[model samples]
Target: MSSHQPPRPVRFGILGCASIARKLARAMLLAPGAAVAAVGSRSEEKARLFAADNGLDVATTRLHGTYEAVLDDPDVDVVYLPLPTSLHVRWATAAAARGKHLLLEKPTALCAADLDAILAACDAAGVQFMDSTMWMHHPRTAKMRELVDDKDAIGDIKVINSVFCFRANEDFLQNDIRVKPDLDALGALGDVGWYCIRAILWAVDYELPKTVIALRDPVKNQSGVLLACGATLYWADGKTATFSCSFLTNLTMDITLVGTNGTLHVTDFVIPYEEKSAEFSVASKSNFAQLHIGWDPLPSKHVVTTDLPQEALMVQELARLVQNIRDAGGKPEGKWPAITRKTQVVLDAVKTSIDKGSEPVEIAN
Candidate 1:
């Protein structure tokens, strides 16, 4: 005879009913060992509407009128913060002070200083801090990591190029919070370039770039928010990376990595075209065989499949960690916050380079 029980689901409280929260709320439903504790918005009615619209169980999930109520809720083990960039530091720090683990959204702060405050609070509170960079949790990303780390597969990486862009309608261009200076001030750079930067760093094993220089002639909106931009990153050992992002192009998410012995390509790095399977190609030591016609060996396609969506995987990972802390008395994991900080630091360098008229900004160790 055997007896065992399933782990208790970690309760999640969502702060700010941003549109992205709907997807995350669904993800929590799919993730193992996770449950919705509450959801909050500026208005209780709005929060109720979000819950009902998203098919959240209103009978079980509490809806709070103000963000503060969710933070103060005794049952919330963690908070999923999807607020604007400018409000991240304030709400995130407060959540930590109240002993809530944090799963913050991307563009975590307006700047590195603000992020530091949030991090400090989390560290002091002995709580986990993870950013909602869902792509990082995908199974395909793990396969790619294995290949990139294998010296036999892709020798020394030399260069990386990435782009993530999407065309916005007039309404989004004019009224979207992403285009608002007081909200997501970094605009396209914060929204889209964030993925590109994270991909580059992941490819390079989270090594901070030595310097970053913004490309010339970035486009900006009337409100002085970036609409399109590009930046180049340089490493001390001569490794280089370039990325561009925009709100004025067709939907595209791509990454191309060139190494000493091979090249790697992924068309949809941020969000896979299909949820069940994702693919990437690699060409190892490809060379001309005949009279300058074609390469000797064609690139090989690798596919990774998963049952749960990447966002759900993200939620599952957070929930697992929360359970460890609650049931087994384990300390919070530091890996996520560390990588997120590196991403933010590189992002800040890119912003600084742009502000300095495309001048190179050095990244401190």
Candidate 2:
């Protein structure tokens, strides 16, 4: 008998027909070990339309009128939840309690306390939990991590800066769910700032900062939702990080890490500009040559190619974890939830600082 084991597919039930769910549905189709088994929405007709529009096979994919029906489906091994920020804790906890693994959207919950409740439910039910930070699964990110972690190549990291911003059109400003207080309470700070905060935390290996201070005079919408904001994070060792996010700027996503002996820069940090390949630049031990006319060493670009998009890779990884739990009786991985909690902690601190008149706030945990 051959020793090769065929891939085990993970059946995913989408909790809502959100726009982001469409991208993940396509990813599930692309992932070899994942399949979209069900789609659910407040409206049955809307769920059916979503399945048809997203090219999910009607024979294979179940359409449910209510989110509860999807959670109650016995065939679903995983639930991909892309609900609004305010709704994550309720739906995610319910899915986990039903023995379905969770692939939740980022800004996992409104705050750390709320996220902990969902995580606690998952832990009690013995189900895996993973936030949908697609870039974390990309090969390019792994390669970059290797370089940044290497002492000789990057030296001691001193500072990190991340920025993620995009101009919102009139429709988005007026009608987007993100700007609605009840929908996404933190607004731009929760939407794009989550990525920036995650990037900074990733650079520091998920270490919590000592203090967080929101920049003064954050731009707010008419409904008192943040439209543009920035924050500074300070570590005990003087390792500092800063991030800025906005809904009123030109499209830009960047991360710059400066070390004692080197520097790293990436233009497209959150989502790669190209789906097929990604690139980052690094420089080490460089100084101006002959009166600053030219440099003796120039930054080198590293390119990583991937056959499948980052989102598909994320699905495959989550599926693999689910398969391990199903076939091998493996304990759920704690790394994803741990990382998510850390990100949420920082996010909470920023929001608290902003609420307190942009005063400095110490991270409680």
Candidate 3:
């Protein structure tokens, strides 16, 4: 809907009592066209406590112990899931069957096939679905795209390198979701590497690589803690992209796109906090004059910061969904921002490559 007037707020039902849900609840309060009307948790007591704490214990407010109950609510136009990765497919499917739009966390499903199922279900139900890949929506990332498309900046993309790692808590073994068996199995690739892959996907306009090679060195159980892993992606355009993700390694959060004319470097690529500034730079391979005449030379340096908090991205994503729903007569297209079948295809290829000793796996066209 073309709206100079504000759209009606989208009432949301959140599944799970995830830490991220709290942030989303706060964000929903701040978001212009969204409202958290209900929350569901496995534990009735927990749901009650959270609802009371959030001042949602009012007579009209809804809070329930089971996620299914949240999905059954007629008031909820969309459901935001912050559940564990394994539970994604089941919950997402159920939500879609109930005709509720879905906002899933990153790395939407275990593999591409599962994501496809989630998308198909949503499509059949005529509801929208999207991964909360908020990084893709930020201005800094948009600027990076501009530089990549610039002929003088990086003429023909040749390679990409990215790393996102942080040492786990020493007592991670004691008990933590990150180290849990199933999640650990997904390893760093699904956890953080996915961001790097998706970033490159967006940069290259979602071109699927022709070949992929992955290596996973599990330091522990079947779900080995991804001490370190590397991937080699061969694209049809003779461009090769590679990235490493680790939890046992030193701190690192960076993505560098190397092209023919110049290289674009992005630090803190994935989590561009509104309060914290991210650094971006592009050094042209062409002479200073060529850079000036042929293109608007990128600022030698750029910083990303929003007056809002880190949760602002989530807030913005939800707001976009609400606006789309209101404008489209309540039948929004795509999931979240846009859940495509391609996302799952690439993810599946990566999983197969990792399982087969990082053997080069071909992505089906």
Candidate 4:
């Protein structure tokens, strides 16, 4: 038998009892290099119930009555923060200052500046920081990126279109935290637009757009929160992208990229229909068949299989980074935070454009 020691598991302390946190807790358990060390919420009973409902071992998972207690746990090497966008800057900075590696949820902060502050703390503490964009960890995403980068396959991208929408029931519109201005604030834009914006940026290799213009006549609730919105991004090289996100439409998720020589299409871009496998279609060239009945070259479908869910892979990757820092004294990886900042910058610009009556807003950096 080979004598290979398993890597040390990174201890994770979850900061909230949010619905999403249950999924993340499951992910942490699934990841080989991660473990749920503790869970915290305002109500001790709620924390206990979360652990019990999520099938976390009560003996192994400590339940804390307060978030601060979890952060203060010396056994917890990382903090998985699933708090609201508004509370990100505060709790994230605090966790970083406490020298805990951070795995933050999407829309890392209310704005880029707030994210920068959290990053600054992580830098000072020499702790790893990563946003929870699970799709980025999917094997299919890397395969798609490889195809897009190949000049012979896709050539230079000219346009990209992304749409993500889901119909919310009446109760959700009235009671969901996502629709509350004080909680999520950004509503549909932050809830769904984030994935579209990230996909657009990823297609362009994270290049900041030259200008952002919000689509006119955004639908907002009475409290002034966006329920539906869209935006257009323009690059200096004539490449353009458009995206629409809404909470008022039927379920749909798509990303279409058109290049000089080829096109890429994926219907389930944000969340795959199946957790174990995903597929994307790509067409390199086009030719008319005899009588122009059908194209000679048809788009080919590529499917990727994974033993674990993408969220689990995301946790494993974050745990690996944290282990590097803890075991080898390695500096935090900058790529994750850099891409996150870029996504947030573009999102901020889109919001600014919307507030300015859909005027074109120049993105700074």
**Tens digit per residue, CA lDDT, model 4, 232-255:** 999999999999999999988899
lDDT of each: 0.94, 0.94, 0.73, 0.93
Per-model TM-score on C-alpha atoms: 0.98, 0.98, 0.86, 0.98
Off by over 4 Å in 2: 1-5
**How many backbone collisions does model 2 have?**
0
Model 2 TM: 0.98
- Candidate 2's displacement at residue 209, Å, is 0.7
Segments of candidate 1 deviating more than 4 angstroms: 1-3
For candidate 1, the per-residue lDDT at 65 reads: 96
lDDT per residue for candidate 3 within 1-365, as digits (tens), equals 35576666778888988776777777667666677878889977788777777656446557788999999999887898998888888999999999888888766887777787888788888777767776765667767778888888778888888778777666754455555656534666677777767766766678788998885653443455444566778898898887777767776777888778888787777775334556688877735555366544544777766554445565566657556765565566443434345655666677787778878899876
Candidate 2 clashing pairs?
A: none
What is the number of residue pairs that collide in model 4? 0
Give lDDT: candidate 2, residue 118: 96
For model 1, residues 1-365, the per-residue Cα lDDT tens digits are 12387877899999998989999999988998999989999999998999999889988899999999999999999999999999999899999999999999999988888899999999999999999999999999999899899888899999999999999999999999999999999999999999999999999999999999999999999998999999999999999999999999999999999999889999998999999899999999899979979988989999999999999999999999888988889998989888988989999999988988999999989
Q: What is the Å distance of residue 167 in model 2 from its true position?
A: 0.7
